[model samples]
Target: MSQVLIESLSATIVDLPTIRPHKLAMHTMQQQTLVIIRVRCSDGVEGIGEATTIGGLAYGNESPESIKTNLDAHFAPLLVGQDAANINAAMLRLDKVIKGNTFAKSGVESALLDAQGKRLGLPVSELLGGRVRDSLEVAWTLASGDTARDIAEAEQMLDIRRHRIFKLKIGANPVDHDLKHVIAIKKALGERASVRVDVNQYWDESQALRACQVLGDNGIDLIEQPISRINRAGQVRLNQRSPAPIMADESIESVEDAFSLAAEGAASIFALKIAKNGGPRAVLRTAQIAEAAGIALYGGTMLEGAIGTLASAHAFITLKQLTWATELFGPLLLTEEIVTEPLLYRDFALHVPRTPGLGLSLDEERLARFARH
Candidate 1:
C-alpha cells in the first residue's frame, strides 16, 4: 500500500444569514461568515471542515478573510504534500511554523481528521478514540437583548423540547440593567430552565463582583468570562468571590492557556472550544488538563455551521465527563445551511452521527450560491 499524500487544500468564504441579530457583548451578528476548508488527498478523497467566527473580527483575532487567506497561502503549501492519514504529524508541522492561527489550524486539523476517518470507515469520534456518548445536551443562548423576547424564545424552545438550558449574553449594557434583564428572564422561566450568562470579558472586576453575587443569588447557573482575559489576577480574584462558578471562554486561547488557567485557579469551569484550542485532538488536550486539574468542562462554540458543529460534536462526544453540557447550537442559529442534511437536535440534545468522517456532505449548489466571490 502506498502512502496517501495530500493533493490540494482550498478554502471558501461563505456568508449565511442568521435567524436573528445575535447580540453579543462586543458586537451584533447580522450574519455568520464561514471559511469552509477542503483537503483533497492523492487517493481522490476530499474532506471538509469549517473555521467560523462571530461578527467578523469582533469576537476573535481571525476573521473569514484572514482565515481563508492564511489557509490558502500558509496552510495549503505546508499540507499539500504531507501524508493525509497522519493528522498528528501534519498538526505538529503547522504548530512548528504557525504562531497563533488556531481558527485556521482547527479547520485544517478537522479536514485531516475527516479525511482519515473517511478513509478508514470510522467516525471522527472513534478516530479520536471511541465515543462515550452518542448525543450531547445542547444549551441555547438567548441573545435577543430583550428580556421579554429572550424569555419568549426560551419558552418556545422548551415547548418544543429543543432546549432547557438558556445562556444570556450580557455585559453590553449597564451592569444593573443587564442584571435586571437576566433576573427578569430567570424569574419568568423560574426553575423550568437553567439560566446562565456570558459576560464576554466586557465587565471589569468591580462590576463583576456585585453582578456575580446577584446572578448566583437569583438562581443563575453559571457566569462566563466576567472580566477581561488579560486580567489574570482579576479573574482569579473573581473566581474566588463569585457565588456561581466562573467559566473561562476568552481566557483560553490555547491548550497552554487552559493549563495556566487551571494552575492559577482562575476558573472553576473551562469552556472547551475547538477553534480556540486548535482542533478536535488539541481541544481534547485541554479537556484532559481540565480533568486532571479537577475543573469542570463546558463545550463552547463560535457559532459555526453544520460542518463545524458536527466536527465539534464528534470531539465532544468522546469525552468522559462534560459537566456543564455544551452550547453547540450554532447551526440552529443560522437560517440557512450549505450541507445536504442539517444536524439533528432533539429532546434538548444534539445527536452525534455514527457515520464516517463528520457524517456530512456539502451541497455544492448551495455552497456556490452562498460563496462570497
Candidate 2:
C-alpha cells in the first residue's frame, strides 16, 4: 500500500450560460457560476470537484467567488501537504480551522474522494459504501414562468422519455398566480407526469396554510420550503395538516438540523444536498439520520455543474432508499459542460459511470472557453 500525498490545490471560477432563465422565489438566474477545484497528488493523480450556488448568495451562504477565495486563502493551504486518500481526516482538519463554508469544503472533499477512487481503481460510489443502483431517476424543473411554455417543455421531456417527474419553481409570483400556473401544467400533463412545487421559502405561515391545501387538493405531489426555515412551529403545523407531503430544503442544512426537524415533525421528506452538509460523506450522515427517523429522501441539487453533480451522484447511488428520486438535472440546464464524457441521460434516468474516480474527466478546452478571465 502506498500513501498519496496532496501536492497542490487550485480553484477555477467558470461562468456558464443557462439554456433559459432559471426563475426561483429568491432570484432569477441567467447564468451559473462555479468554482471548480483541482487536487494534484504526489502520486501523479489529479482529481476534480465543483462548488456552485443557485442565484449566487440568494440561495445559500456560500457563493462561487467566496468558495474560490476561501479554498485558496484558507482550505487549500491546510490540504496541500495532507493525505489525499484520508478524506475523513482531511475534512476534520479543515473543520478545525474553518467554519460554515460548506460549499468550499464540499468541493475539497469531493476532489479528495475522486483522487482516492482513481488511486484505488474503483468508482467513487464503491468508496462511499458501494452503489445499490447504476442509474437514478432525475426530475426536471419547469421554471419558464409561463404556463404554456412550462407545459410544452414538460411534454417534450416526457415525449423523449428524458424525464417523467417535473418540479415547478413557484412562490416568486402571487400565490394565486403560481397556483394557477401549477394547476394548468398538472391538468395538461395529467397522468403523464408527476408535478411538484418548490416555494423556496417565500410564504408566511398564513400564506402557506392556504397555498399548501390548494396545491395538495389540486394533485400536487409535494411542497418544498414554503415558509422560512426559522419558523419551526409554522413548519410543524403545515406538515401536520398539509395534504401534500412537505419537504424541507432550506430548513435541513446539517445533521443537527435534520434531527431537530424530525423531532419537531416539521417535514416528511428531506431534500439532501452534499454542498449543504459540507461534503458527500457529511450529506450521507444526514441521510442516515433521516432514514433512522423515518423521513423519506430526495437528492437535491444546488444547481451544480458536472463535477459537483457527479460527485453527488456517486454518493447518492449508494443510498439505501431514494423515495423521491433526484433533481440532479442541473448540468442539463447549462448550455455547455466541462466534462470530457458528457453524462448519459435517457429513459428518465442519469446513468452512473463504472470508471474510476467520480467517473468524469475535465474537458479542458470547454472549461477554458467558459473560464472567467
Number of the top-ranking candidate, with lDDT as the measure:
1
lDDT digits (tens) for residues 1-373 of candidate 2: 6777999999999999999998888898999999999999999999888888887789888888888889999988899889888998999999998988989988988999999899989999999989999999999999977899998999899989999999999998888999999999999999888999999999999999999999999999999999999999999999999999999999977778988999889999999999999889889988998898999999999999888998999999999899999999999999988888889898999999989999899988998998998
Q: Report residue 367 deviation for candidate 2 (angstroms).
A: 1.5
Output the number of the TM-score-best candidate.
1
**Model 2: per-residue Cα lDDT at residue 345:** 90
Residue 72, model 1: lDDT of: 90
Model 1: per-residue lDDT, tens digit, 211-328? 9999999999999999999999999999999999999999999999999999999999999999998999999999999999999999999999999999999999999999999999
TM-score of every model versus the real structure: 0.99, 0.99
Flag regions of model 2 displaced more than 4 Å. Answer: none
